[model samples]
Target: MANNFLRRVDLIFDQDCNFKDVLKSTYQRSNDDIINELLESGLKGRGGAGFPTALKWKFTSEQADVEKYIVCNADEGEPGTFKDREILFKVPLKVFGGMAICAKVINAKEGFLYLRGEYRFLLPELEKQLAQFQSILDELKIDFHIKIIMGSGAYICGEESALFESMEGGRGEPRNKPPYPTVSGFRKKPTVINNVETLVYSFMIFRYGAHKFKELGTADSRGSKVFSVSGDTPKPGIYELELGMTVEQFVEEFGDGDTKAVQVGGASGFCVPRKRFKDTIIGFEGVPTGGSMMLFNSSRSMYNVLHNYLEFFEEESCGQCTPCRVGCQQLKLGIEAVKRGERHATYLEQLQKLAQTMKITAKCGLGQSVANSFFSIVENFKEEMIY
Candidate 1:
């Protein structure tokens, strides 16, 4: 808890990197050396899932297939999340370098960056930096190369399997699991798909060494995360900070004086009311996020907040599974009914149960995680949801 204070870290945005130096240093290290460092550092997928980076690369590398792929999930469609766009904008090269390193670890000759459709403006500058990067790879004789592809702004496409489907010229829908991306991904080959910030941290871990990274944050959540702070905040912008801090500490720094609740993730994430702020830690040990921290003040309506998020989930659901597709619509309608006094407040208990069922039966993370915000808001702010 000593390190839980909101100390700002500048490793990702330092701009002190020379990709050649990082990659050249990488040239001397074997795949085991690279993977071992990642494992030691405990670097997880910063895309909110928190899967270990080392295992994704190691598992993909272990596949017998000769045609493995590495993908950067750049679909920044999560509501209240915009750090990925900033990372790509301010430090495109680091993102590329991170992908290159992963490509090497998995023996991948080709990598793809799935850029969000709205970020098309970045392609020109990204291409220039990428060409320069590939030339350096050519000079070093590294066998990796990367290409850029644009997304269609489907929120579900942010899921790894759905993104793969879109990349394969099919609809962006999530595939059933057990055969994850590491086993069968784009083209049904072995793949390692990491988020934009995840890749940047991978590169930074290599550049700064894993021990230094390990020294920060708690045991379960190692290293710093880039957070997109907005809504009822004095300082509403991107800030990289160490993990394991309570929501209270966060509100103290970023919250407007009248802050009432904080949405730790995005629309699909949990809503922490002011009462639980002191007890809630914003990490895997408590509530984990994909780096979207939206603060709401007392002036705002929790009912409206919950409504907006439910509507987003209802509209964005791919509608593949009944639990998710129908669940979202019913949840929205359920709350509306309660607000209008059309249903008894006790009906919310049934709706909460429905959300819990969706958590179990929903096919993808999109439908599954809706329960997080639903339960958190309804349980804590029950009065608002009713009247």
Candidate 2:
């Protein structure tokens, strides 16, 4: 009930002035100061991983590499998620300012916003706004620059390494991690990959100071997050909520009638039955903060929903690795078998084991999290899976 950064969305629209200008004026500190403030604030990545943002920047900043890069992962291919799209269209300048600040902090000369291919309609509009921002930067003599790279709509590219490969004009398949993007990303330079919402918050953190930013959200999860609620929700758009808001409150506010379950964090995120929703809260502390929530009512068929999700994964896989390519194929086959009442209980057990193995052995996050939706839905709603 208390208003914090969650309600800033309303303020942004209600106030007639430019939100970018307000942010620039309010948070325009030197790069060093901004980085220090962010470190103190304990801001973690709002994207799926929830890595500490300050530590990520510190790693890149301290690295002895000559070339450094910052990338905004705007490739929002996760089903039921559209928060990044809204930010790109509604608050383009803030996204730009955040990237500029990130570049300055890491002393990176260049940045890129890797947008999904489906966002073709927004490209021209983004280009126009970007040009306007460029003029302002030129007048101000800022040395940093950003290019908008369009993705081929591959869900795998949402993974950082895959995004890097796509930027290099190759197929959008994921690469091996450990040498990670921080040490060797984007043409073999140290790079920082952040979500669109995470970068947008950077401008706010830089402007308002980290301590003030910390004042809003929970202790561990320290910020507000934007969730794109779809499916059975009545107001099925974006809602900015504090990190720790319970799922019950979220569902009651926007849920359609007779809500049965909710999927937090997107296609790769877990599904919670109505009973679990009451206890769960939004944030990286417990539940994931992947920025997508699809509510389901009793009227909705769990099998159909999961089938749709699996179909998405089957089509979007980059097919570079055997586990992902073959595993996803097997999963799809298993789903079809179950649907047709041809799968034995033993086959279902095998699918579960395969899901676990894929989580641990997959080449990247795509293969790792791919089975999440299936496993969660099946485990929680076993009754629905049977004829």
Candidate 3:
């Protein structure tokens, strides 16, 4: 397990440019082979959902010959997820290379990096890196050019469809699914949207064989994952751990001695208390995360944590849909009411039921995932809310 523990795909991380030579070999192979390699690697999107990267590529590739686009979601809006920001700052070429490879597979001539507005400071340097990457594409004669699209600091735009809407110069509200991004996206063209880490992993998986990449992680979740650890951790920083490690293992390695609960994603993820940490695995099999692991010690207040998260979601909701806008408000108020003794304990039960309804009926992932942290924190630390 330790051998697979720190399996860093260091080609891009440490500025190893040898990946260009590896990509040159891919030009001779057919697109199907490349896509199939991704399929076999069992790589999933690192952007929370854990959707199959290969399937996204396959669907977009199989679409009718039209103007297709590849989008890299660099909108690192999640509270604790800054891994994408680091990748965008340091190893942008890996992102470009991955996008180029996806373009080659899906026959897309253009790509976009939807950068979060908070990261606008990194733009000047990123443009310089992209210019260098463009020359490499020119040398390889790959007919792909990546453009940078800056988001206006809207957290809802982190959703692919909302990002698409923002790219089109509209308000960033999520579109309904079924005609998902693969079929109709970004000006109604077939588009493939991947998070920053997912694109980098795609680059590595293509260079190293799928079997080699598959050797690292568990059966359910393949490949190593980059976790951004914070909050009461001794070593609070970015960690590249092989997926499927128990929460207990992670806490033991990084916790600041008195860790009591762990938030396994950002505000929109699950909270694992000390009792469940021993059995909890941080992967798709147990609790899948989009690269955030915030450890909370016993000193922290669960009510305050939930309040902070609720405040974030409340302000970030696009307000276009009633369920999200109104539901988030009610959740925040319900928790506050409980904390202040203004409402009976049964009020929380009503809010939980409402949260269940929101999960089923909300517009997109933002609204749907609000219940995750709400329920986890409230259910685990009920005493904190009441008294």
Candidate 4:
């Protein structure tokens, strides 16, 4: 088993033999065998939501709908999440292999990789890689085919339902629940939507067997995750590190000595002040992330950070629901009012209360998760907002 220390693993990008070999062997296994292996491995989605990948596959496979689809959520539009783009650019074969595995398990013949509009530059090479990957699929006689779909640059599309809407030629907005992607997705059929990194991990798990991954992280946060580290860090880039490590340990490795706070997960993620670094674990048992870690030194302003996040949510909010639409607008305005000495510092509490309400009343994760960053910042750095 793995401990809480940050261990840099060579699982994801480590390549040895041809990827087709891995696919050839994986395709040999029964669906039950593969799903059982994935279940035992405890692999979860790397897309921050952390749903069990095995259950997603099992659920989709169990569904009676033969006209199912597999979706690779390449809409990496989160504020600080760029690892998926890097994965798609560097090792697209692993992504395709993972999709093919899922397709076999679910008995689907077609899939789509919802590419972010901002990443239009990667299209040409990505298509080139896709051709090669498809050739391998043909050689292996796997009927599964993967296609790339373009996104119109909406951050909400990172949400599965919203991405489905965009794919179906509708406006990029979140639909209501009770009809999740697994049961009704991508043309109202069963769909297994996996993140770009999650798919790579799936491919890696099947390539290296389940226990190799299951032995990496703590029980709840099994396996290593790739993080997109940015802001104030000397070594800001994509890193594949073990989970269950403290923010303090992460800072020791990636942060400057003057680091004041670390934002785990992107703008929507919780902000940890310097004082709380040691206590904060970067995993599901602590602060679950979609693999974005941002460091801020004492020189950086917490108020500005909060303001910037609020502005992001306000601009990104689909405006479908009143709480997110109004909450994002007011939170940004409310923080600004206090900063400008127009409102009493007590008004900060009101903003926090509103954030809490939005967490409950808002329709989707975009609206619900605002309170994660909002309250964490205001509570830890109240003085920043007042003066």
Candidate 5:
């Protein structure tokens, strides 16, 4: 079934075949031309925020610097978002190809794949692929070296700044923005940080040009999205589908059962009840997410699921700021209060208000978006929380 999905998308990954050929063919253009083509195609970042990839490259490339770097955020720490891991294990070379293209476009001499520590077993396979990719680069004379940096299993490290800190051998915690990674990153050099899937799309955009790629999905959100569909589903796995496909269509494709709600994005993603699912489209404009769809049945306890998510947030937060460190603690405690039926209704309301504040004022994405799962679940499934 997975193979069928890959074939449908023209993905060049399969069990019997390694991706050396795909990588070789994807690099058929000069760096400048590839950048121009990407800009013309209008490819946005695949990793949630949907920032323009070409503009990001242009900005990073224009920085007058002797040394620059491109870092792939392979730290797929988003709970229920396993697309990156699937790509790593299956179509690694395509990701490498995209990284190489990014390096060349941004004039970066080095690239790093900052993979999650939980993906330690895939490291040996990645190392082997990197060696082969090095040979491919040498054959093509592409003048850049890429390295794989394993994260220490911290969810905070998935944030670009924290990932940089982890790469630099520091405790994984976010730094202040304004000196965003592009301006000052990776040993204080100009850097381009992109998610793993975003880099893979870069390969496609440059290869087929932007227009062909844009034909797949919505005007605002052009191209297909890879989703890690799990939780209370008969066929739970990674699915690559066009953006703008309604949540209803998605569930139908997966052989619909009693889906009470669907969580878009990851643990930090929003929850849409069955009613809203029909209106929900899969893209930045709708959910503003990274395409991680986790379904929940009516039998599933919304309270229990929320509790599990809170536990994850508590463990994964980098303990950097008062908002994330203390805020997560308070949220967890509040959930516990609900579980034990000890909190007043007003306390839940207070927790919701605090989450909103964290979303607005938190220093980094971790704290800012960490409240999404809880708030969305609470808002959409209020009856479940009423005890």
Candidate 6:
């Protein structure tokens, strides 16, 4: 454990007791009380967006849909992030219990665990766990049931709207906003979709009172965060820490001595170089992460990092909008062109502007977030990017 690392709520790893009875007893509480407790805890979505979990539940629960859903986004495809796979493999019942709790709150009869295609090998065991949970729910006389679906390994499916599209038997492309998922989602019904970690926390918040959950982390980012720390680090694995630690603290604990930069929150997340480590916080107030903390040392090339991310975006972009489709290719080629001396070093300014346009007009988060690391790496590591 790193400095200031506190693990109070245990849902997945190192859990001793079965949580089924706890979940069964929770139904005695009113939906309003549960949602209110969640709101008071200041719990945010662990799925990168950091949206308030209580608000999403309240929105879907208040909707007038006959059939509602609770979709657990287990498609942990973000590069260098694999914490969900461990949670699904080890303690899937907690996840299902969390989902069943949500279904009870929102009056949802059905729920789906959208497992990543890469985790297909864990399906048999996950199904077995779900069956066991289903039996528990049946014993409790809860009308809700859960089914598992596997994704086709698209990185874009990690996005909430795109995940919905994939769940609906269509290509995993993000839908436009305004009629957000709470209003109409998952076969055009009111739905509440939460990341695997978020749902687990929901169960934890219920188990331990909201006040206890609020004791850890900063004001905005309350509670613990499970980080999938990898790359250039001495110890690369999942570590749960109280949310408001600085990047410097994280690096000191996990990073190699030669660490130069840390990409907080995977490729789409911000790039925090060593210079800003002390000033940068790791929680929602500073650079909020979705469980990916990739440390890079002096040996790693910033240009290659940006190039790899751009390549991912170019291949993963749905290409529904011109900004994301063309901007990704342009950014990838722009960096390559500079490296090849085909384009002048000053051309990076123009490329930055192109990236800015993509942030504004791109259809989904996949395209908009490309500018985050792209501009950060290009601007900070210009010397390394160009000759």
Task: List clash counts for every candidate, in order.
Answer: 0, 1, 0, 0, 1, 0
Give the per-residue lDDT of model 6 (tens digit) for 20-72. Answer: 76797788899999999999999999989999999999999999878999999
Candidate 5: lDDT over CA atoms? Answer: 0.80
lDDT of 4: 0.92
Candidate 4 to truth, TM = 0.98
lDDT of 5 at 122: 99
Q: What TM-scores do the predictions have? A: 0.98, 0.93, 0.97, 0.98, 0.93, 0.97
Off by over 4 Å in 1: 1-4
Estimate the overall C-alpha local distance difference test score of candidate 3. Answer: 0.90
lDDT of 6: 0.88
Badly placed stretches (over 4 Å) of model 2 are: 1-31
Instruction: Kindly list the per-residue Cα lDDT of model 3 for residues 28-102, writing each as its tens digit.
Output: 789989988999999999998999999999999999957999999999899899899888887888888889899
lDDT of 2 by residue, 270-350 (tens): 888888877886776567857888889999889888888777777887888777778888987887787678986467778
C-alpha lDDT (0 to 100) for residue 385 of candidate 3: 87
| Runs of candidate 3 exceeding 4 Å displacement | 1-12
Query: How close to the true structure is residue 152 of candidate 4, measured as C-alpha lDDT?
Result: 82
Better of 2 and 3 by lDDT: 3
Q: Candidate 6: where are CA atoms >4 Å away? A: 1-11
For model 5, residues 1-387, the per-residue Cα lDDT tens digits are 432322235532434433455455556657677778788776788767788888888889888998999999988878788888888898788788888888877888799999898999999989998999899889878788999988777878888888898899999888888887778998988899998888888876655667877777777777777888888888898767767777777766663579888888888888888988778877767886786788888899998888888888878887767787788889989977875779876688899988988898888887888678878898888768767
TM-score of 6: 0.97
**Per-residue lDDT of 32-149 in model 1, one digit per residue for the tens?**
9999999999998899989999999999999999999999999989899999999998998899899999998888999999999988998898899889889998899888889999
What Cα-based lDDT does every candidate model obtain? 0.92, 0.80, 0.90, 0.92, 0.80, 0.88
Winner on lDDT (3 vs 4): 4
